[model samples]
Target chain A: MNRRQSKVLRTLARLVIRLWQMRRVLLLVVPYLFLFGWLFAAGSRMDVRPGELYGVTDEPAWGSPDADHWFGTTVNGADLFELSRLAMATSVSVAVVSVSFGIALALLVTMLFVFDPGEKRFELPNVVGQSGFLLPSFVVLLVLTGGSGGSLGVAILGLILVIAFHLCPVLTTWFQEGEDGFDIVAGYALGLSRREIVMNRILPKILRRLVGVFATYVPVVVLVEMALSFLGFTGDRLSCGAMIAYGQGLIIEAPWMAIYPGLMATAVVLVLSLLGWRVSSAMRTGPLPRLF
Target chain B: MARIVLQRLLVSVIRFAAAGLALIVLIELAFCVIGGSDRHVWRAESYGPVPPGLSARPVSWAGLLEDRVRVSLPVLFICVPGILLIGYSWGILGARLRRFHGARLLAAPFSLFACVPGFWFVVLVAIYSYFHWKRPGFADDLIVEQGPDLLTWWHAAVVALPALAAGAASQIRAVSSVLEREVTRPYLRGLFMAGYSEEDIFYRHAFRRALPALFAAGDRTFSALAGSIVCLEYAFRYPGIGSLLVEAVRLGSYGGILVSAFVLAAFVSAGVIFCESASRLIKPEAAGG
Candidate 1:
């Protein structure tokens, strides 16, 4: 065999060993992958127009679980399985958008604080970070949206605002702490502009920590969405929270209606939380300093 | 030393007040925006409807003060104790559970439990109530009724257990990591050689060092509880500030929303401030650093 071929084989063998080491984490990913795949397929097949019933049929309401309808039907004749899949898709999108916006806002706030520590204008963001941690996201959403009966766009916008504001404080703290640990004085001595230092040197160094923070906050955002949906604050939206709420009445008569959605929500949350924990642990460099 | 501590306490109080004022203004502005009011007044009644024959009256500070206090009291009563209990229990359990070998495995279910949304608990309770309704027995009495009272407080506590457990488990993981690092320090080895029992070394030296971290974890747990309580209150349909806020939002009661938001923000800030002060008192040296 040629020497290049032997080098390629050795690299492949090392990759296999690494995969074996991560088998436990991979095991956790399997169910999430299966669920997401199913959700994608179901979401593609169904025409989901927000605030309009799509899956209603002539099938008996609260029907027992059978081959035709895998998770039975809601009292309104909406397919339980299809509703759950749609809910999952909506939840995933909401979480991604909110967390992304939250991270960007946090980074901006952190940069402002780091660069202009003396300015009184920055104090508002600091107070927000502190106070935001204390108030629940849903309370903020409800207050901002003025309760349910709004359009889907408004509801999603409200979710984004609440989640983003709620998370900004934690992320600001994380980034500020990370910046403190960096050698910014040395960067200045090397003739780097403040913006350049913050954007290129400091942010890249803390990128892993940023990912860790995102992981930690995603589960929180998901839970907040579910809670809001459960409260009927998401404006006629079908979410895991809504599905669970709808299924609660039929637990005994049609247990699958509640159980399937409950299990789906539970599974999604569990997987995300576990993944968050793993990512944070793996990326953590040393003992985490106290945020306060 | 006493003067220094007192000065620190004063600074914290001032900071909290400033933040509280800012939050009130923000909530007021939000109310104004939602109500389409150009008035700069903080009173809810500023944006409230007036009779056609009557002009918009000037803001009444006394009536506003009374209304704010009345709206805030019940929510505080139910939420304060519930949050404190959850934080205290989780902190204590986290500190104590660090020694077990199987703690990682044990924490898995708890972490999952923590991820269960607040409404899921509400749904579970509803389902339980349904089955209980059919049988008509003992469980029916403990379920929360329509209002926020001691009964609702108890129900909130019961529903909060899973989330609390999750918080405690995560805290345990964090505390244990810190403890593990402390154990590896050379001072611990010296103590082991100096005729001190392992338990004595742990309790007297190690646990003391771990207290600061544990207290920090407690702060995080308390913050989390603050968020979860809103959902719990909503699910139970309890007449707490959270539910009141939702109703106000639905009806577009700018005054109610403003009052509720201000009260909730103030309470959360106070809770955090209290936790910080308590943590400092628990470990004076750590606080100094």
Candidate 2:
């Protein structure tokens, strides 16, 4: 088929698959949405005025539960429910950005490792980039958070870089595995250039692994971001981890402060893990042939 | 045959124990130099004057060991047994056991982290024991005092080391199982039936077959540990090399940064050594003279 025709067919196939998967995920999401909505509507209104946190202790806004604040009021008296929503959105964005960058970097690096194993010059640069893996993200985040910008983009970029660095090995391995089929060897034997072979052939197989990897890493992304935010490295106003750390001191007066956010974060992670498993299962042609 | 099997088992245990002990000592020494003092012994002794012998020792090895035993024993005794029981139960339940190749590999380290919940359980027991043993009217408050810097770093190392060791042990088991599966494939079976067995089959045939991929797996495991360790250390406030590195970051302490970098580099080097050693065992011919 011509390039245009192939692209159209690919788009159609992807749309069908996405819609089918979305239906399942949406089924799972509906109950969560209902729970969140009911809780927010039924919960007390928060006074999370701009530049104000909940309680007197500079804790997060979800620090107390009462008739005035069902989820409880933070030390600053901000509604716990609303702040939970914001934390949820921030976490979802972090998960998306981190997983996207991680998968992309993994694909690129793995392709480099697979088709061009001994070409040291290019791979050397890749290794140097990977040396950043050992540098704790907190250090970089501290340096960055110390700077002026606290934009959402900066936080996303930070989270993505951390997740991507962690993902390098997995991406590389999956790429190597998917690239090792008879077709790839045949392509090389037939004198297809490395770029042509990787782009036209290896990538298709690698793409199959993307759903699985993306599903797997999303939960980890959420956890790492929570950690980063907890460490005060996120630079944003609030994060799931930051909320947990900040709210712990008020665990007694406002148990909901910890309970609500912690439950949200945990649920999101569990969902991502289950989704990852589903994606892996869905991609199965059969029992996977072992690769040596 | 039984005697030979027993000998190999003894050798492997000795080797594993030696590596584990060497790791503990080396990490403690590194924490000592970083913490910059050595007054405490057995626990953080903030109120006391320094003993002359401890001050004069090569690396505060005894103080470090006491701290390690004090902190680590409770945590490990609780976590190791608990996880073994849970993992054992899961193993029994069959389907509930993680079967995904990647998930299984990830879980070894993840479960090690997950076992931190066991620390709280340990602390409760310790508190109960203290009361049971006739409390000397100790402070039972949750907010434990942070005392002198003397060997706080060592104490952190001692606290962190067991978890790291456990994490490494699980990863090795997971990766080796994956490697074994990879090496014992049908194609490898073909090479085996072609008049190879045992050493020849593993080294000459299987090892050659799996080298690139094994390195690939090593890279992945190493990277995953890198991300997880920092969070784990920070959560426990374990003043390991990673935690020191993080504090250096938070305070922008350049000395802490250097130490952290040096220690992290050492770990990466150790990982490389681990890979090389594993390769040698799997395929001796690969390191052919």
Candidate 3:
């Protein structure tokens, strides 16, 4: 083949690899982006008074489904449809942001186990991981939110800490396992320090594990958020959880209030889980790449 | 002799701790159920609609748990015992079912059945049963509407035990593998070749060697099951301490929330203590200091 032909073939190969690696993440994230867009659009047309959405008033209770009001009115006179959208956005954002923060926290913790003894101070996070796993995230979110001021930031921050701590243990274990490779020991033998060995040798072994970890965890993170929101811990504005809470009141009246958001949450979680399974399988079965 | 005594004492302490923590959690759940909701309190005028065959009594904590346990217990009994007995019997069954080749297919169903989040599975099963077995006059009629109540810890235990049993069994496989690998090491091989019989090699040598890691692995398995239960409880509306704790926060029930947290903390602290004690038992020489 000519040089041009070889170059095009190489480009196509690279694209295929990148696409395959990205497929799971794209599948999981696209629905979220769509839901979020709808939520933002719904919020822009917010007709309900602010406090009314939080259950301080009964305006949401009075609105009826119509051309103007897509979702019937709540007892508080807010548009149920509008409120649903807002809740979707709030809930998704909380889950996604908290999960992102959690993955970052896990990465940092993994680095400590793999490299940099100086970063070992964060071992407290791993101990927290033990308790964090057994105690439901919603329960922890509740305590953290209930104890702190019920500000959105406060709740999110508290949740982030709970999630971060929970993730660190698993991350630490993965890194620790990868750290046991022959390359790492060889690097140590070649006069490289522990830190150098981890950075240069162990990181490659763990790259795939890290992908598996992140992919597997996204669904779990979303479920935690849904539970929290369902309990009304995620900031009160039409969160997925808040909608369900509202639906609890309206089960006899407008069962859609609960069913819609419940279905949405369930769908999102299931998709992410399936995608995670696919990604992990791909990572495990793929041909071993040449070490540079 | 001192090491044996210490080991016995440690085991006793852990058993006490687990039982005590489980008890405290039960009491907290009772309080939350009875005192939980003051919202929209109105009497149920009559039985509106309940699934046929299932009787709906006045919403009482004791009744709710008893009812749930009654409904869930049969399934749990069938699944748990069936899975364990069948899983262990697979190799035996293979000889008989050689034409059917059922053993290979058996593990996945058992594992999936075992792995299913009990809350979701129970809810799905309950709904399915409700639809399938509908009988006349079974519908619950008028009742007082109140905020959700907590599910008893006994109920949680009953619902959780089957899953836990299945999980514990799976962990046994993993724990034994670790034990088998560690016991076959060179130093241990030398000891075994010289004098130790196979039984002594397993009990005295392997058990002692693998107990620490097995305990740690036990913790991992327990936590994974517990995590699954959180969502499961929430889904089934089983007001176990885990879910009550979630609801308490939602309702701004600070006292209830605090009590639940304390109970959870105790359970966790006890688990850690158990793991530590077991580790010490396995490596008495290391713990001597």
Candidate 4:
């Protein structure tokens, strides 16, 4: 082959190595996303939103698990498989948006109020923001949402806002802990510029810590959405928690109804948690006992 | 020193109040915008599906107050001492026994599950309690109901368990780290050179230095417990402040939500100010203040 062709083949080899190196993370994340997409498409066709289909008690109700009805049937004869998928999709989708916005807002709060870049010292965060440290996201959301009835749009917006404020004190404290008390003084004494010192000497130390924050916060936010749903504040009535609430009652009669979805929910949380621990331990300050 | 502390306390209180009052004002503004307009010159004409104005209802709910006093207060009281005793002892021990694998072993859960979903404990406890001991349906209050007076305190312990579990985990980590840093500081070496005893150096100097950190941890734990109570009450369908808020939101009762929000906001504001000032007072700089 010509030099250009050889170079192209070499690039393909490198690409294969890169994918091979990241296979562990991809093995977990891709299937969940693909399944989410498939379930979302299926839900769109079925046109089954949680609250809209909540009171759906029709014929062939409470059918047991079989070939056609994979998981089972709800009281309304709606496929439990579809229900679980839609719920998972709803919870994960909302959590994704909420965590992204929340983290970004938290970073801004830290930069603007908590960390005084001008003085290079920490300042107390807003008092109301401190209130978030005292209160959970759901309490604040309940207070703020008032009577929105947990519509999809309202739930997403409310979750984002709630999570953002709830994270302020947490992020601030983490940043504070990340700062070694003597670092700034030592850096300045060395004749380094503020920007140079921050970029070269400081930000790297804290950036890994931020990765730990992201790992832990995502699952927590997903759980937040689920908790809200558990409290009967389901948007569209489609959440993994709401499904569990409905199925849990029929545990003896139709165990599969709750069991399958419950397992799926557990699996999602478990996988995320393990992934978080693995990633954070690898990047965090302390030594880990072993390789995961 | 007393005068300085008092002055500093007053300033901190004002700052906290400003933050809280700002939120309260924002809530009122939100009410005006989203509450649908019906201002009758000086007063709102009717309360409608939602309440009319901020002054339309009394700020206190008897049930809310009872819940706060009976349920949440006991939990808070229990948690404060439990966290301090457990956090301090574990941390001081962890620092002294830094070479012991068991110290790290004990703290494993905190780092591993620090970010786990908050409600898992509540849910799991409710489920296990239900399956193990057949009580009320739907895990409502798990095993407790509006029974005898003693059971109320029992229920309080049950409710506090989740927060305590998570809080202790975090506290252990925070305490150990702080103590580790303090134990290694040069000042401790100076004390060592001065021929001070180990326990004296630890309790007097190292522990004093770590007190500010302990206060901050307590503040964070208090917040976590408070937040957890809301979720727990809602999950249990208990007649407490959390369920009250959930009910208010469900029914779209502006009076209920607003008044409850105001009271809780005040509590949060006062608690934060006290914790912060208390922390500052312990700091060496408070002398200059």
Candidate 5:
């Protein structure tokens, strides 16, 4: 083949790769938007104040699904559709808070490794974190509650504490990965402190490589919040898990209640993970070389 | 080489065992502090005796522990082999499918499954049982005619299905990555040209080289499963340690927490040490990296 033929074929292949990446990004955005959407209606806020979404009503209870009630009414005469929206919002907000808090805690703890000798670095995070797997997060939360749950704010704070403790070791281990490149060796040879070499030379590279990985954990935090709620460990919070818990009870009467939130959680978990992988791949693929 | 690996394994066993013991003591002390007790709390903090909390009645830690072992051990046994076999098969499948739509088709679903949290699996299984069996909830006495430990575990094993899927999904990715790197090595091409049979090239070479990584995946999958035991037991009410934890927590029994945490922690420590040793022992040098 002539140079022109080879060049054309290469360009076509590059085009195909770009299209695939673009499709992945769009796929990620769609589910993300759905999670944040007020699927019941944009008019949910107009119908009742956000505060009233949680309150019981004297209106007809257990009403069937109709144009006005997308998910219908609960046994308490509360709007199931509006309550569902609130549950999702609570779940997302708590997830965002807990994940950010967890990462921050992880970073703080990982920074300590910079001061430690290299041999300890290998053993400390690996063995210590592995053993931590034995201690259940639910048990910790229950312990903190002293049997009965407290306020939602306190429960969220407790949730954040539990999540951060569990998450820190995982993040630290991931951050500690990677071979010592020439730059790191040079930094060490030049008599830089372990902290300086790691902070200045190594961390930036690891962060860049794992940036997409961080988003993948959001769905888990959401699900955990729901699980705790379902188990009645989250005090009075009505998150997605709580909604599932509620719907599970009324299954014979209102199967849609449980089904909708369960479907939403499933969608979020599936899509977010796919997005994370794509993002990781895209990062690895990193701007392909320009076609001649 | 064997001696060195054995020594390292022994050292690891000693190290993690010591750590687990120390952590168990620390957890017991910590709970004592939280529940507000005297030195007697520490004195009476023996396994199998589950020193009664402020109000909870004394329950035999041995029986509860036996329940946990019966359910969780089978899950672990079932899950580890499932991960290894499925991961190994899928990795081998990749080499054949490499020329066509393999990466997209094989990878995407596994990637999704791999990231699914363990509780989600419990929830999925719970949801399925709810729909299929028309059961409102899972409880120990819910079935009065419980059978032998082995038979009872099969009932509990209903929840292990999703866990196996998640674990196997993660392991598949690990095996595939290692296989891809191993098969593409320049030395492998030279062997291809030197008249080595494809079977020998794969099983005797690439597969052996992949053993350490496969063991590492197993180790990780085990740890992940250990973390999920509480959720699994809690959801299924399988008379495991997790159910014990729920009972303890509901009744505010610190002794219950103490025993349950100790058992699970011991299991994890033992598992981690075993897996880590095996992974390192089969270094590509021994297996031929």
Candidate 6:
């Protein structure tokens, strides 16, 4: 083969080898993907009415798992399986939005800090920002969203903002460490502007590290969102946490109602966590150390 | 020595002042944004109960601060002992358990336990206890109602166990890694060849080297505990700073939220400083390393 074809073949081989190495994680994640797909496809076909299943006077309460109600029925007469699907969808959506917003804001703030290192001298903001995470996130959400009376969209936005704010200090610390290790003197010698060096050289070099950090943090955001939803702070949203909370009272009579949702939530977190662990481990074996 | 202590104290005081100011500014900013008003008005209003025209901001601030301080005392009482108990026991137990077969078998579930949310455990226990209390011929003495009281040590222990398990899992991993690294060092082989007993080498020499990492793990575990304390306190409906902050937030009480934030920050800072100091006392050379 010619040189270009040979190089392309080599790259494709490397990709295949890498994918083979990640087969275990991929296998672990397949069930979640299948569940998500099934939920998506079956969601529209399933009746959306809660009263049709359980709210009626004659309807059985705390039904066991069966063909009619696969996951069982909640004490409040809601279908556990359907509620779990909805909750999982809502939670995954919130987690995606929150993590995305957090990472984006972290990148922006990290870039800002890189351009102006003057803020480093004032450690107060870092401390204060960290305290945001230390404080109960539900409180922050409640305060920001004005006692959770807002729409689901607004609640999600509030969660995104708070999570992003909490993650800023952590991301900034990682990014700062990366910048510190960069050859800034050499960049200057190369006659690159500050923005050019940061955008092109520093950022590109640290992109994998940022991804590792982002993966490590996604599980945290998911847990935080779950906690907030469990506390009824997410404002009437159907979340795994809310499902678990609602099922807590009937845990003895109908344990499936709680266990299924808990397992689903745990599955999501475990998958994201393993993905993070894989990414971080790969980065560790690669050129960079694990940022998180 | 006295000068060093004085300097450290001074630095801590300054740090606390800065943190307090930063917390106030953050609260003011939050209030302004949420209330959709001018920053200056929020700033003045946050100083508290001053009727907007009073020159004595300090007095009102101090009075408000005292109330918050009072509110935070119980949180400190509950969280301090709870964290210390969980951190020390779990850290030491986890490290020691890494050697045992039975404990090794638990490694997977313990690691998975770290992934589970603390509130889920709390709810499950609550439900279990409720059923147990309702059991026929169950003793009245066994039916202890878990509440948000300061004396509810058992309640704290139960609620804190999941966080503790999570912390212990990470601690076990950290300790094992450190031990693995230590085992591969040349000095370990040298000690083995020098006629030192295996237990002596592992427990005396290697353990000393592992202490710093173990302490660092403990620090991380404490921080995790602090994070989980918020959820635990809230889930158990504990009257700690966490639940108070939640209540304040729900009521849109800016001053209460600010005060709780400040207290929580101070508590964390103090815990970190204390951990550093203890670590230094244990291994002075490993303070910053």
- Residue pairs with colliding backbones in model 5 are A226-A241, B284-B289, B285-B289
Query: Comparing candidate 2 with candidate 3, which one achieves the higher TM-score?
Result: 2
Worst 10 residues of 3 chain A by lDDT: A45-54
lDDT by residue for model 5 over B45-141, one digit each (tens)? 4333554532145446665566456656676777667766776687567654656635445655655664454444555555666678777445443
Q: Compared with the true structure, what per-residue lDDT tens digits does model 6 show for residues A9-97?
A: 99999999998776755654565477558656535332343233323244446778888877777655566776776766666666767
Q: What ranges in model 3 sit over 4 Å off?
A: A1-90, A109-138, A149-151, A284-292, B1-215, B221-240, B243-255, B269-289
Global local distance difference test of model 4: 0.60
lDDT string for model 2 (B1-289, tens) is 4554455445444434443333333333323332333522124342233233222343343453344234433433443344344432332222122245443544545443432321222222233434575432111122346875434343344344444443444444444445566565787678667876656665565555555445434533343444345554554445344454455455433334444444444444445445444544554345440
TM-score of each: 0.73, 0.59, 0.57, 0.73, 0.74, 0.69
Give model 5's TM-score versus the native structure.
Answer: 0.74
What is each model's TM-score for chain A? 0.73, 0.66, 0.69, 0.76, 0.70, 0.72
**Residue by residue across B211-237, what tens digits does model 4's lDDT show?**
776566555555555566676665544
Two-chain DockQ for model 5:
0.20
Q: Measured against the native two-chain assembly using Cα atoms, what DockQ does each of the candidate structures obtain, in the order listed?
A: 0.34, 0.12, 0.11, 0.23, 0.20, 0.24
The predictions' CA RMSDs to the true structure, in order, are 6.9, 11.6, 11.1, 6.2, 7.5, 7.9
The residue pairs found clashing in candidate 6 are none
For candidate 4, the docking band is: incorrect
Q: List, residue by residue over A209-237, the lDDT tens digit for candidate 4.
A: 66766766666667767767766665546
Clashes of 4: 6
Please report, in order, the local distance difference test score of every candidate based on alpha carbons.
0.60, 0.50, 0.51, 0.60, 0.60, 0.59
TM-score of chain A of 5: 0.70
CAPRI verdict (incorrect, acceptable, medium, high) for model 5: incorrect
lDDT of 2 by residue, A102-145 (tens): 67865665555666646352454345444454343444443344
Maximum-TM-score candidate: 5
Candidate 1 lDDT by residue in tens digits, B1-289: 4654576467556655664565455445445554354654465445564221111244343454354355335545544564455444443444445566444655555666677765666666666665776532112235545665565445545545544555556655655555666666677789899988877766678767666555555455555555565666556554455555665566555555556665665565555656566556676245321
Worst 10 residues of 1 chain B by lDDT: B50-59
Cα displacement (Å) at residue B69, model 1: 10
